[model samples]
Target chain A: MEPIAVISIFVLAVFVGFEVVSKVSSTLHTPLMSGANAIHGVILVGAIIVADHSSTNLELGLAVAAIVLATINMVGGFVVTDRMLEMFKGKK
Target chain B: MSRTLYDLIGLAAGVAFILALKGLSHPKTARRGNMIGAFGATLATIVVFFFVVAPKTGVAHALPLHHLGWILGAMAVGLAIGVPAARKVQMTQMPQLVALFNGVGGGAAALVAIVEYLHLGSGATKAEVIFTVFTVIVGCVSFSGSIITFMKLQELMTTRPVIFPAGRFIIAATLVSVIGVGGWVVAALGTTPLLILAGLSLLFGVLFVLPVGGADVPIVISLLNAFTGLTVAASGYVLDSVLLIIAGTLVGASGTILTRLMAEAMGRSLFGTLFGAFTAKPQAATGAAEERPVRSGSPDDVAILLNYARRVVIVPGFGLAVAQAQHTVRELADLMISKGIDVAYGIHPVAGRMPGHMNVLLAEANVPYDQLEEMDEINPTFSQTDVAIVIGANDVVNPAAENTPGCPIYGMPILQVANAANVIFLKRSMRPGFAGIENELLYDPKTMLLFGDAKASLTKVVSALKAL
Candidate 1:
């Protein structure tokens, strides 16, 4: 939880991201992008955390909206990516 | 749940996220990779709910069920909208669909930050306030920018760049005010300034993308995708969640790299795309008037050419998607192949708005993967090709990129379809492509223009070949 430790982890993750993602062929770039889009939908966890702990009605309302948006982002992102990948057939 | 158990779940989710990215690196494993990623997302969501919220233990000293109903209701709403859209959307609209999904994610991050800021109630640590404010600004920009892109792609608005005389001045002023108000919110901890910051950021997003032409949308959308990732990362910093930090950083870094690659493919840099005043470059006088006559043909003529050709290459573009001609083109290829002619498709790296967009369309039409050749691989064989068929494609095959200096797309790699003995173009008009520039390849004596709807033209050609 130390700032230095967190920053270090972030820096390492950046290299890992570039390393893993750069290997994707240009032909798969769209799906790669869509898949990355889904991964960031992990922010839905943040929305749920805020919504659950919300004290006031206004804060609760905003958090619930956030949850809905994030959920759509997550579900739609993954499903669309799957649909795209399914169409990627091998040489017949 | 104990703190140790919570951290354990986060760790497992992080590993799953990495595996998901790994799976996506190759087509053979991409579908399974997506499933693994989705599983990780579900696990992370459930873990946060149970480990952080539902438990009676730990730091949360208040009621947990107050907004539970609203949260579930919102989730149902997301499913209602997202599942069907993902299921039924035609493949042609994939770019806008991705943009819309990206917008929602961004809006969610911004909203989450706002709620957290309110909950802090002026007593939060400086780091927390700073991170939360960062999320609010970036997320709002990504959200609004993505929606504008969606509208353009969907044709609710013009796909052409909307530039005005004082556009740059207005954008500069709005950006300055956004930063000023954002600084005020951080120093004073006032919700009012924060609200103003969000509004200005949304406006800034609209202005930011308005001047960019359609040819640049893929890079803009990819960059916005990275922005959403950074927003999520900032929210993670606000919440001090390690899993969120790792996952967000991964997307942020990868999206940035992809954006750079897309830009390079178009021979433009990210700096130019953002700040360059790309007001509609005039449509060049195509030299069609001075040049030797361009051969024009009917569908029957094209059918006869294909029927006699020993080898053929098909280059597809966004026009193919617009005309929904993939299936018809596939039938034509099949007919040619049945006559013992070799047929191959040339795929440009940044073709058809999104990466691999043409390949996905071709796959839908049951075009074999091996027959889909990349630009580098197919360019060399064009000289040996008896007939090069360009279906609704122009910019990618344009010779201007290699031959003409001062042209916008100069020095960019292009398909060498011009090298073929005979080139057949299926086009709607003499109007330029998404890049808003004329293609010199159209005027080549060896090129024959087949002007009509791509599907109707291909269908006619198919029938003509059948009659033969």
Candidate 2:
């Protein structure tokens, strides 16, 4: 239940993640990034959950800020990506 | 009680997800790779939520009902919008779609940093405050920069770079001032002034990308994606979240590498990418003289040229990708090969909007990888080539890259297809390429312009070759 143990676990996960990603060829990168970007929404969820649980005002404010900024990033990113996708439509 | 075991599992899953994504790069196994990646991600998310968050933080606080509702609600909204939009979008739109998604990641990271700042109030530690400030700045820039790139790519705004009289200077000053003020605020007052700084950065993002034309969008998007990754990593640092840090760093590093590669392919420096200016003029000004060129050829003539040539090289461009002519091109290549002619593909690094665009299309057509030669390899061969067939290619083969000074794409690398014995350019019209400049290759004496839809033109060329 120690914080260090928890942190270590997460760190280990990330190291593994990096090893896997490094091997991806250029061709697969765009789609991989796209999928990863969507998965990043997990961060928004995590931040909001953490923020809402804050017993103190400082924690509460930090959490809310995280939620709002994370939400904006997630939503805005998807919108822009969609718009980019529109450019190649209907070309003969 | 066995947190170590769970952690190991989580790490393994994350690694698996990454490997699966890497495998998805080739078309042959892309679908399976996608499935594997999805499975890995789902597993990692579940494990993190359950073992890491629940047991340590305790179940009561970890799965707060209201928070769970919000998570579900967000998912609902995301799926509602994302699923339909993704389904309706054509493949050509994938790049812009990626930009939009990257922006969201950046924005989310910024929001997380803000939340951390607000939580600190007056009693926050120096480390917390510093992490928070860094995350906000990087996150805001990534978010806003991505939005600008999206607009440029989508044609909602001009694809041409928007340069004011003193645009570059203004952008520089704004960036300097923002950094100065932001550093002072973070060093002295902490998160209190960060909101203002974030606003400034958002503006800076728009200004930075506005002057860059559509031709450079892929590079811009790649750069922004890198920013998003770095910002996310910084946010991870703020929250002391190990997974966030790892994920962010991976994205940041990979995105950066890709950006650099893209810039190199375009023969552009990172510095040039930031300050490049574009203005949309009618393609006619660039297309005009080419239309009147005497060498414009019909399919029959092109076919005759192809029939007689001992060797042929097909040069593909964004136009081919736009027309989705890989299969047709493949058929044409096959037919040519059957006729005892040596056929090879000349791929320019920056041929399409992204790196390897031409290769991806060719691969889809089941073309052998060895036959697809990069610009360097193919350029030398073009001189000996009996016939060079350009399929919807423009900027990459345009001689202007080598000869035109004071032009935006000047000094950028291009395929030297002009040196071939015979050249055939397939185009919808003589429209200027993404660079918003005329293609001098169109007027080359050896070049024969074939005007029409690329697929249609290729089909005719095939039939004509058959008759010949």
Candidate 3:
């Protein structure tokens, strides 16, 4: 990927991020935050890539732990956020 | 999959996340939004095993990756631990649970960066090394800072601000050392400087969270969440993963917005919240709190007040959640409504342990959404309210926020319960609220205090109201 392309993606994403959650009420702040948290768990891709190519024992071990932690972050984050939003059933 | 196809799938996943954030913001679309996000994440994670990023120039190298079994087993281990914990966590413990998840994500990002750095060795580009250094420091800081927040919310440590002597100076020094060490890592590559950089970042993280307490906690958590997002972005740049960069940057941007909104809702400035301990005056008046005379009342007295009021407003707080009295409180609200009293709940923006936490608890107990009024909506109605029942809450209703100068909670907004004709507090004791500040409302002439567990007192009041 070109440096210019990456920078363009980052800059465009920032505007989108601000616009999307701007209208959310305080009532949904927790879920919104947790959802965003889970998205970053996409870091697992980077972890797997690193772990796949790790040549040394130390590197492999650390990368493996990263995978585990990233999994928990992504999985727990989404599940917990879902549990929270479930309680926000529409008014009876 | 070919590289172009893989990148295109990653683009689709990024689009899913955008929809997820957009959906999670509103109550009507929340659940579906979450599912969409989960789908995208699953897609991204599964797609990774099909190809790998070549170490030197960020090219796609076809899989199968080495240690394939280890990666699968590790992910399995993560699932085993994460699923049950998320499933079993009580609503009251949700904040700390979120904190814990955030911490691990940050730690993972840090570890991943370290591996990439070591794998690249001296072949790492100057730009890549700088990104690695950024990820290492911010990731470690977020990891450790979140742990302290976890401990604070879980009651493993005191919830009050843990300010120490010359705390600001120490915090400043740590910041300097972290940056200094970071510069060293970028200037010359070595395992030692990187490890030292990680250590200093962890220490800075702890020092950073120690002085933040009270309603400001959620703000810190949100800020750290943002920190982790940026760290992931830096890691993306280091690994040359376009998918990671997009997802991480989006989170970083949205988390920053959320943090700002949280601070604004609490009537606080982010700068003040982070440094208020050093600049604000110490609360030296708590000792005098025990000596003040409060109008101690019986459950019967509380019942009489509620029964007579034409309009009643209930203010729920952390204490309500602590006693797990949401259902009982709802019952009392139903009883009042049946009596033809205008009943509504006064929910502070920063009520309970976090923003919107009380709503989750109340919603869990099946309270109607229409009856729950946010701080701005309910603030004006208090003057017209005949009886204001404050159940296990303090700081949100405290007057010190408006009247006092130099107190820790002075600039924060609070409920105007003092304007009500009668104010009733059902409390456990004379202890101050979570911010460790005394409430002057308890000493007001029109105020009444009922001493007991919030649930028990509400139950007794219900029976008395029934008898009446």
DockQ score for candidate 1: 0.75
Order of candidate numbers by TM-score, starting with the best = 3, 1, 2
Give me the iRMSD of candidate 3, please.
Answer: 0.9
Candidate 1 local accuracy as lDDT?
Answer: 0.85
By lDDT, is 1 or 3 better? 3
TM-score of model 3 (first chain only): 0.95
lDDT, candidate 1, residue B212?
Answer: 76
* Residue-wise C-alpha lDDT for candidate 2, range A1-92, written one tens digit per residue: 24465456445644644554555444444555564564454466457546544556565555555555454444433443333322222222
lDDT of 2 by residue, B1-468 (tens): 255765576456546545544554444555555555456545654554454243112344433333445444555565566556656655556677677767766776777676556554665566666767777777788789888888877778878778787776888898997788677766776554777888988988888888886777888887887677767666665654555665566566556666776677688887777765633222335435655654788999998898888999998887887888888998888999999999998888766666655554565456777677777788888889999988887878778778866677777888888889998989897677877788777777888888899999888888888887
Runs in model 2 deviating more than 4 A are: A1-45, A54-92, B1-40, B51-62, B84-88, B184-192, B276-294, B368-370
Writing each residue's lDDT as its tens digit, candidate 1 over B1-468 gives 776888788878888888888889888888899999999999998777566543212265444445668878888998888889999998989999999999999999999999988887676778888888789889999999999999988879877678887888899999899888888888999889889889999999999998777767888899999999988888887776888898899899989988887787667778877754553354457566445556789999998888889999999998998999988888888889999999999999867877778888788888888888998899889889999999888888888779876665666688999889999999988777876677767778888999989999999999999999
Worst 10 residues of 2 chain B by lDDT: B55-64
Q: What is the TM-score of each candidate against the true structure?
A: 0.94, 0.81, 0.98
Cand. 3 Cα-lDDT? 0.90
Models sorted by lDDT, best on top: 3, 1, 2
Worst 10 residues of 1 chain B by lDDT: B54-63
Per-residue alpha-carbon lDDT of candidate 3 for residues B1-468, written as tens digits (9 for 90 to 100): 777988888899999999999998888998999999999999999898886767784454556877999999999999999999999999999889888899999999999999999988898988889899889898999999999999998889998888899888999999999999999998889999999999999999999999987568889999999889888888888877777888898899999999999998888899999988778877675776779788999999999988999999999998998999999999999998999999999999878788888888899999999999988899999889999999999999989999998877887889899999999998999988888888899999999999999999999999999999
